[model samples]
Target: MQALAGFLWWAAVFLSPVVREATLGNLDPVAVAVFDIPLFVVASAVAAFGVKAAALVSAGWTGAVAVALAIYATVTTEAGWGVLGMGAATAGSLIALCLVLLGRVPTAWIIRGPFAFRPAIPRPTAASHVASTFGQIVLFWGFFLAAIPFAVAFLEGRWAVVLLFPSFAAPVGVAVLILASALGISAAVAMSTLGNGTPLPSAMPNHLVIAGPYRWIRNPMAAAGILQGAAVGVILQSWLVVAYAVVGSLVWNYVVRPLEEADLEERFGEEFRQYRDAVRCWVPRGSKTLRSQKP
Candidate 1:
């Protein structure tokens, strides 16, 4: 996958000049050949050969160059398609970089090494759990959903890349927001009361929680959060914010989920394994299946 991503990154960068010329009525093929081609070739080669350190450096360099090009195009070019193309290239480069990083490091270390969950001593009281959950909701809702979308809008405005949502999307956005919020609240309540812990990994629950939303889905909180993020993007009418939400979900799924599940497997063993096998991660199972499964 790393090799494939590197090759794709190279191909995208290699073709970018033609894309730019076709979209913006400008030609600068030499600039791409001189600046981008060689670096990406090296990145691809290193990744293909499994040279971990070299792959990391080269992929990071490729991503940096892509980001610079994207910013330059956004700021200087009048062509929206050109800017969007650059953004896609930038995203590809960053994904390739992430692949390199993930390939080089142990997956378990990502969630367990530096950011390992520390179970509360003497157990937290119900009031403590409530306070913690409230704080988390405020932080996630305020910073991630509200502040970040506004910030992206501000940047888009400054860069003249503003894209607005249709008027008809407002009701759909509101409905999704309400449903996702309800799911998140229910999941949090289940974790606090049944599992005897808060949602924060630093203060994770003591018992396996397979009640409420968890009886049907393995990660109701994560599902709810991702959906809520996308809903906010719809409400704010920002494609960039929606992309941000998608990127967050990918990070959580690939990077965080493994560590979390690893910890669970280590602690709960057969119980967690059984629950995991029975429930889908993001999708809720049917009521018929829920009836058959033991929580």
Candidate 2:
């Protein structure tokens, strides 16, 4: 919810005529996108922090932003695309807040509802986890990066969605690439450095990791790839990628988690369950009083 809100808010900023005239006046957006790619990475951290803290301050800030936008819209009275886009964002944010408060988020299935981290090593777990981590990387990225060429080819051949490239598609796709890379790498680093394990159950960590990005969310690495896939779908405006994300999320929730948690229970016994029950899997319960295990 917070991720979407932040993205939409920034989208409004990018699409606003003032910004477009200031930065893109008679200039190609591709050049700007190249320079602005770093901003996309920063934006991911911003979103992570926002989501981690949203439940605390979202309602107040969102209401304030809405009123500010409403006054601006009233003053301008032109009802331009910018105002409309901003309204949509404000509306979405409010709705998301309400749902979050009610604990009825439409996306609950995609997030904290059915996830857990488990460390179980019946055998040569470390190598197995390392291999699994690498395999997951290949599996997710192979399909994710493949979308660019496929989108280019399919759209170019079918309907000639050429106009979508620089102005809309490229920036978003590039943003996803950067965000995904940062998140995925962070996840791996946290696991290897903090947990003394790889991402795979085969080489399950000797210690539970609640450090680095795991300090905020349980399935940071998994969520990174999944969210990246969804970002691609949004950028390309393709239901195929969106469908992949949805199906993948469901798979993670229903199929993958159960097996992983069972493995965890077998390996860690009551310890795994206690952590799972105490901490949320994806949507960041926020502000653990105790410090994480020191490296």
1-295: candidate 1 lDDT, tens digit per residue? 4445445644654577654453343435456556545566555566556556656665566567556655664566534444555455555555555566664445555556436776644354666776778788889789988998888765565455667778988789889999999999988987877676788877888888888888888999999989998998888787877888999999899888988888899989998888888888887667435443232
Error of 1 at 140 (Å): 1.9
lDDT of 2 at 149: 37
After best superposition, candidate 2 residue 67: deviation in angstroms? 53
Window of ten residues with lowest summed lDDT in model 1: 286-295
lDDT of 2 by residue, 97-177 (tens): 555555554433332322344444534434555565677678758765465536533533332112333457657766886
What is candidate 1's CA lDDT for residue 102? 69
Off by over 4 Å in 1: 1-18, 21-29, 41-47, 50-57, 77-105, 112-114, 157-164, 287-295
